[model samples]
Structures are given as C-alpha cells and as structure tokens.
Target: MSIWWSLHLRREAASVPLARRLLLGTMETAGVDPDVSYDLSVALGEACANAVEHGGGASRGGSSEAYRVTAYLDGEKCRIEVADSGPGFARAHAPRPPRVDAEHGRGLFLIRELADHVHIGDKPGRGGTVVSFDKMLKWTKDPSLLTA
Candidate 1:
C-alpha cells in the first residue's frame, strides 16, 4: 500500500516538530525500522526548521504566511518535500561546513547526509524554497504483498 500526506502549516517554531512527529507516527505504523525512521525524522526536522526560519518573507499584504510539508511512502521508498513561500537562497551556493562552535547552519548538510537523495529548488514565481528528499525504507517486518 502507498501512503501520502500533506500539511499546510503556519510559519512558526511549533510547526517544525509537528511535521516531524506526524512523519514518525506514519513510519512507525508502517513498520519501518526504528533507525531508518529516526534518520528520516531528524532530516525532516531540519527541513521543516529551515522552512519556518527562512520561507515566509514574501507574503503579500493580509495574506497568512504558511509552509507546506508533503510526504509519500510507496513500497520500499519514501519521499518528502517541504516548501515555503519566502525569498529563498540559490542551490548553486551549496551548504558550507560551519565552525565547530556554530549554533546553526547545519540543516541542509544534515538533510543531504541522511537522505538517499536531496534536491533544493525555487518554488516557481513566488520565489519560495523547496527542499525535497527521499530515502530507501527498511522495514523490520516486510509485508509480502509489497513488491516494490
């Protein structure tokens, strides 16, 4: 079976963990290995945090600013995308290694390391950012019907 969900959340600190938890629950229910789930959850947290922090600077007057998180689980692969409607940075400027004592600037790096594939791009005309990633799912108990 394939599972998918999308959440349109306010650009706030609380939204980050909410997205992560929802992912965790879905993974757990799907019998994904704990270690794999943990890795993906951390990566999701980083992406969501980035969205909350830098994805909502271009809101028009009176419009409620928000970000979107979408996740898809199909067979042995899971794909996730987080998008925000804010002025975003360019992908050509790759994430740099931060100083050892730095308090921040590690989100994209973590996402790239944890996920099997990561892509960053502009969200079309609105000039927002989108962080999309996918990981090969490992299940402790494989379901016989899932061929892919």
Candidate 2:
C-alpha cells in the first residue's frame, strides 16, 4: 500500500532517534528549508518524546520496544503523527502541570502552539494511538539573534 504516513513498531525511547532521522529525510527531500527543518524537528522531537514517555514506552518496565512515528509533507503544510502500542491516555485526566514548572505537561501545549493543527488521543487502541501535528515550512527561517 502507498503509505502517506505510517510508522508502526514496538515502543521504546531509542525509536525516537530513528523517527527524527526519518523526519529529517522527509523534510529535506520535500525541499523544506533548513530553518523549517529545525523548527519542525523541534516539534517532531517533542512528539516522539511524549510518545515514549507518556505512550506505551514509559509504562514498560524495561521493554525495548518501539513506537510508530509517521509524518507527511504536503507543500507548505506538513503532518506529523506519533503513535505507540499501549492503552489509551486520559487527555481529560492529565493533570495540568503547575505554572511554576516550565517543563511539565507542556508537550501538548507546545505541539498545539507550534503546529497549525494537532490531534492528541495519546492512545492507539490495543496498539495505542497517534498524535498528529501540521506545520508549515517557513516557521524557522530566522532564529533569534538575542539568544544570550
């Protein structure tokens, strides 16, 4: 079958590396600028991390399985999906992290903030689910020069 975006596998942290590589290849091949690649990569990485940490990978005692991360690029828009093999997550029950912490429970928020569209089931039924993000190729053209 013609796979538009489908990455199926076990659940593990190391899988994220391959996922990133695949994304880089896809973006590069799609003629996406390096800047766009970087920004998209950031969003992509965060998604993969979430899949591993909050998906099924995190629940595994020490299983070396891998999750699925598939992304599709359509002209100025790119669609990314991350799915793992595990029970569904509670999008409604995820306790919103306190504001004091700058790094907790912010993945979904960041994903939504960066991408044009986001779909988070955080579960894939029997094999878990796939969270998706759609973004453009111009979001990373100019990096901040005031990074001190």
Candidate 3:
C-alpha cells in the first residue's frame, strides 16, 4: 500500500513537531521500521526548522509567512519535501557544510546524510525555496517476535 500526506503550516517553530508527529504516525501505521521512521522524523524537523527560520522574502513579512511539507511512502521507499513561501535563494548555489564548531547550519547537512537523495530548488513560480529528499526504507523484525 502507498500512503502520502501534505501539510500547509504557519511558519512557526511549534509547527515543526506537528509535521513530524503526523509523519511518524503515518509511517508506524504503514509498518515502516522504527529506526527508519525516527531518522526521517529528525530530518523532517530540520527541514521544517529551516523553512520557519529562513523561508519567504522580507517584503512578505512574518505575519503572513507559511510553508508546505509533503511526504509519500510507497513500499520500500519514502520521499519528503518542504517548501516555503519566503524569498528564494540562488538556485545555482548549494548549501555548504558549516564549520564543525558552528552552532547552526547543520540542518541541511544532516538531511543529506540521512536521506538517500536530496534536492534543493526554487518552488514553482518563484514562490520560494524547496528542500526535497528521499530514503530507502528498511524493515527489521522485532526480536521478541522472531522465533528461530
């Protein structure tokens, strides 16, 4: 079975967990492995944090800012995308890993490390920036439930 969902959220820190919980519930109900679900949830949080912190343009202002997050699961693979309505970044430039001691700038790096594929781009019609990533899902048997 395939499952998918999309959330249009207010650009606020609190909104990030709402998205993460929904993804976790969906994955659990769909029989996804616990570890895989946890990793994706963390990555999702980072993406949403970036959207809430850096999405949209200055003219748009905080009062009306919003972001969109989508997740799709089809058997052994899952894909997630987070898009914002803020001023977009330069399409040709990729996010560079920050210095090891830097306090911030590690979100994208973590997402890239966890996800099998990552794509950063402009949202449709100059809307804003989009961070899309996918992971190969893996399933592990519950040890207590396994009888040799």
Candidate 4:
C-alpha cells in the first residue's frame, strides 16, 4: 500500500512555508532519507513559487486564483504535484538547459534536475497547470515493525 496526501493552498507566496511544513512532516513520518527530504523540499518550494507567481498573474492584478499540491510516497519514492488556477504552463515547455549567467527563468528547471520523474498536467476544469515530480528514496527497514 502507498501513502498519499493532498493539500489545497492559496495562490500566495506566504503559502510556501505551509507547503514546506506539510512536506517535511509527511516525509519525516515516512522515514524518508534526510538528503532526499531536503532536495524535495527545495524542489517543491520552487514549484510552489512558480504557481504563485504565475497564478497571481504577476503584475496583472489577478488575485482570485488558487493552487493545489499533492504528495505521494511509497517505499522507494516520494512524488509531489503542484497545481494552479489560471495562466498555467504548457506541457511541452521543457526546462531550459542550465546556463552559467542566466538569471530570468529556472524554477521548473531545478525541479526537473532534482526530481527522478517530472510530469506537467493541463489545468483541470477551468484553466491552470499542475506540475508533478518525484524523487527516489533509499529503502530502510525497522526491526520493530517486523516484530510488532
């Protein structure tokens, strides 16, 4: 059996901390590796930031939007999905190759680089995008559970 949790977060930068807390708490209880948790946190943070930035319409005064985040964890992997309300990203827009001096776009880029698998889904119902990514985890066993 796999463990899965989903959260609906407002489309605001302030929600980043909330998202982090949820991710940390979920992964920690699952016995995920420390390094993997850190990486996934960073990746999930970036994905959330992008959702807020783009969902807010940046300078277009669109503040009625929201986003959703879902995380699934199994014995060997942790997968997360970030969704937004409107102005979602296109599915085919692959993350650009890293550059030494570029400074404009790179949120999804980092998510792709760090996650073992990444999936971008079209907005459901209305308009928005859901970017999903997963990271592999090292397997560990607890003797207590076997004896329980």
Among the numbered candidates, top lDDT falls to: 1
Candidate 4 local lDDT, residue 38? 82
lDDT of 1 by residue, 11-31 (tens): 889988899999998888888
Tell me which of candidates 1 and 3 scores higher on TM-score. Answer: 1
Provide the lDDT at 133 for model 4: 91
> What does the lDDT read for residue 20 in candidate 1?
91
State each candidate's clash count.
Answer: 0, 9, 4, 0
RMSD of each: 3.2, 7.4, 4.1, 3.9
> Which model, 2 or 3, shows the larger lDDT?
3
For model 1, the superposed segments whose C-alpha errors exceed 4 Å read 61-64, 142-148
Q: Which stretches of candidate 3 lie over 4 Å from their true place?
A: 58-64, 91-93, 140-148
Clashing pairs in 4: none
Q: Estimate each model's TM-score.
A: 0.89, 0.71, 0.86, 0.80
Residues 60-125 of candidate 2: C-alpha lDDT, one tens digit per residue: 543325676777766567788877655666676864644766766777777777777888774532
Please provide, for model 4 over 31-86, each residue's C-alpha lDDT reduced to its tens digit, 9 standing for 90 to 100: 66667888899999998998888765432334336677888887677889888776
Q: Quick one: best TM-score, which candidate? A: 1
For each candidate, the alpha-carbon lDDT, in order, equals 0.87, 0.66, 0.85, 0.76
